[model samples]
Target: MSTVPPLNGSWLLRGRDGSLSAYAPRDEAVWCRAERHPGLPWAPPRRIGGDQRLHAQLALGQGADGYAHLVAWRPTVPGESGLVHSTHFRPHLAALDWVPIGHPDRKGDRTGLPAVAVDAEGRAHVFARNKGGGVGMLAQKERGGWGPWRDIGGPGAHEELAAVTGGSGRVELYATTSDGILRWRQEEPGATLVPDEALEASVRPGTLTALPTSKEHTTLFFADLEGMLHAWRPGTDPVPLLLAAGPGRVSALRCTIDDHDCTLLAQRSASGRAVFAACPTEQESAGLWWSESGPQLPVGTRVALAEDAEGRVVAATLSPDGELRVARQKDEPGLALGAWQSV
Candidate 1:
């Protein structure tokens, strides 16, 4: 398979294209390709949308119905940007013909990257930062239309939104405010979003990443300004799991192995290498272990982790030179990862 940089964020979804489709940004537009199987070469990349003004950031998710969803914004004028586009790929057709989702903010207002999550009923919830630094959301209507953007009050300015689905019909969201406070929102199927208090006690600003471990639990991960990685489960106290001791970021994903809950974390080390850690949901603190699964990655390299069709954990990283490298964990029970191989 060919390797490409995650210029606009990358996503892997099953049942699309050849049962596995990968999406990323190339040049001024987003592109995607797929493979029939994990070990096979990928098909040629196909451009998604957005022309000369396409932004370098994008969000992707897949719904229960097996449709791949994508969202992005494009610049319209100097100091003014408006258009927010949404698109999806039907596994049967294997195409990404985009359609415009009405802009939530005014024409000249700055906007953050869009985050999307799908509920049990196949409805998509999209969240983003509005001009006033509060969170705004749009819901997909059952009649195949998008509802108007509603301002969900929160304290976050110019921060990307992260969201994950919990249980059958619950969704949770996270975002960091300009002042360094991480806020959250939760909702049930067909219910309004209820804002929750700040999550981690630390007021140091940082990005948020989250995944649902089970119907009753979801895990949030973030690296503070000090580059220390923290994991928080809603009802429990926050834990500082990894210390970067320097500047870097963390990415994580939740998956199942042999019917056990598993989570994988990739953090950039102080020395500019990507380090990995794995632990079960019940042994978050006791069984936490690290491994050198791949070569040293450049600082700020983007990492994405997901379970392939065969239920093996697959980690993909985009290097500074625009190459995508992949590594997979063996089917065994330990936190062991195979060597990195170029996509």
Candidate 2:
């Protein structure tokens, strides 16, 4: 049996101008490729920044300005120390060099994979599991600097954390803990995030993810211990969605299809094929459906989903052999997907 790998972070990003940029970890460094337009061929992958083996998948977070922020956590070695670093990508400009964000610990390197979300004002907030199994965060200062790492509190938090900017411009965070789900919400845009004990559920740790459904609301999704998928939001109980065919992480993105607002999802199935599902935004109770969309992924693959400038949903997967497969939403009807293209 092929063992599943740790959950990889978001590797596909859509810039403000409708161009798509894909990133992957390779040869102790991160590589990037971009499309000038929707139907144009993707540029060959190019390595970005200096070489340092990443400890987890590269995390991409974009602000309202369409700038993509890249974050990664790397291990320390004899002559070097492990740390979390970040850089930003903007169209027509070279990517900024990776700047060390420091580890969660001042005297030690006990940090897990880093997750980041850029706020409306373009400040990048990065989160990682600390030495005490709690989440620590470092945010960009509006005046132009990085803030100190602070423990945001998640006593038994899992390493797979998801951070996203809500439609209202505030940032929200969700993490699966030993007890239930822990969430942090910003009272307002660029404000401090307050912690709350989210509605309890038996969430399979790495499968926890969130999709912003409205300016003030976001829906959380995860598989239960039995591989059953459920969707939940504040003030409501979890609405069971469907049974997942595997134990892989779920990637969800809010998009529009046939003039209707919808939420699209992608996950690697038990047989190693990438599968997709969709439903009207926040209407999982109405009806939700899933189908296989691409070729079998190599062992340990995670599908990343994003919406391009043309309002079509795009799914991407990076295989172990360094191959990138992409699929886009077809225009015909409900959640139809075009053939997978290897770039």
Give all TM-scores, in the order shown: 0.86, 0.92
RMSD of 1: 3.6
Over all chains combined, what TM-score does candidate 1 have? 0.86
Candidate 1 runs further than 4 Å off: 1-10, 16-18, 50-53, 90-93, 156-158, 178-186, 245-249, 257-259, 331-333
lDDT of each: 0.65, 0.77
Give the TM-score (vs. native) of candidate 2.
Answer: 0.92
Off by over 4 Å in 2: 1-9, 76-81, 91-93
C-alpha displacement of 194 in model 1, angstroms?
2.1
Candidate 2, 75-162: lDDT as tens digits: 6655334455556455334577667778776646545667889888999888878888888888899998888888888788888898
User: What is the number of backbone collisions in each predicted candidate, taken in the order shown?
Assistant: 2, 0
lDDT tens per residue, model 1, 175-223: 7765544445555584556777565355344446676777687777766
**Which window of ten consecutive residues has the lowest lDDT sum in model 2?**
1-10
Backbone clashes counted, model 1? 2
